[model samples]
Target: MSTNTTDIFTIRAAPGTDIWRKPPTTNICNAPTAIPPSTRSTGPLTSFLSACASFSFPWRERYDQAGILLAFRRRSESSDSGIPPKWIKTGIEFYQSQPQLSTVATDTWSDWSVTPLLSSLPGAETEQWTTILVEKSEDEHGKSIWVYRVVVDEQTGEEKSRTALREICWVYGLDGEWDLEVVAMAARPEKEVKDGEEKELVVKVRGWEVKWEE
Candidate 1:
């Protein structure tokens, strides 16, 4: 069976770029809220089964991130509604002077989770690469989308381990009115460049794969 994969590429995120929605009752003042620009490849949401990617970037500032984003938009909805599409982004995020594996899901508001990388040490340089997978999964309760942190063997180029990071239960329905946009996204919400400074956060996506329903 053949597989669909993307070539190695980079995504440059400027200052003030982010993809997030704050919850009600949470103060939006002093927070950066904007849809971060992304490089996208889209397909029918019903045809999407799974996606995985391996990526890395230098960790320098708070909220520096790069990873896979799954965005869903209803076909019949108009842009005039002023509603943002539901989305999930999973990847490496810099926080507390270290790099963490992070995931965010947004339906009405955004919820975030982060954990230290299993192979990393405090104050050590960031890992050479980090891999993640997002896929539709089911258990006895019902259907849902699952996110996983994947560990790969460097010598053999095979999967070494997989750890579940999050389970998103509300993304399973919509009939056929929704389409999916899979994106390679990066963001730096707090790092502003000075005048004449050309520095930017560039994330290197080494590998990307998406599987569709057959």
Candidate 2:
């Protein structure tokens, strides 16, 4: 299938739920909280998304996130049906009370898994410019996997260094992985907001690409 990419799109989250998987207690997978109501779209299959932006979260909650969402729907399912059964989001996440590159994937009834892209101490934070990518590829075992990566430039002393950043992968079946799409930007609030409550989270996204199989 041909690949289609869209121009830069800015996504705003008004505060509520964020795309996450905190089972047994809260499962708001299908509909992500804190996402701007105006930017949600039901479109073509999208498999890859690369975005650069400055992120900010209203409250420093553990699961709070603002990043690229790789939403996947089953071939036999309706595009308008609730939310995609399987999906993945990777970017800056507040984990263990620290800002770390985090990726979360969900499957079947909001079952989710968290993968920390960075292993060192004091993970990256909300900076001026950051690069994040979520792509589907085959692992060394030749299995279909989703790769999450981050890149940042750091300066030590008088020398500047380009870091590869952090990377992590997860395996998923490719049998029914056709209907895919990317949410250019998405956010989830710490908790559900009240009727009159306004939780605003803005993420500036620049340069993005979307690709999928026909």
Taking all chains together, each candidate's TM-score versus the true structure is 0.82, 0.63
The list of candidate 2 runs beyond 4 A from truth reads 1-9, 30-62, 109-126, 152-177, 192-198
Q: lDDT tens digits, residues 41-124, model 1?
A: 666776788888888777777888888888788876523324346888888898888888999998878899999875765463
Worst 10 residues of 2 by lDDT: 156-165
**If candidate 1 were superposed on the true structure by all CA atoms, what would the RMSD be?**
4.5
All predictions: root-mean-square deviation over Cα?
4.5, 6.2
TM-score between model 1 and native: 0.82
Model 1: residues with Cα > 4 Å off, grouped in runs? 1-3, 24-39, 78-83, 121-127, 174-176, 191-198
Model 1: which residue pairs collide?
Answer: none
The numbered model that scores best in lDDT is 1
Native-referenced Cα lDDT, model 2 = 0.50
Error (Å) of candidate 1 at residue 35 is: 16
lDDT assessment of candidate 1: 0.74
Residue 12 lDDT (model 1): 80
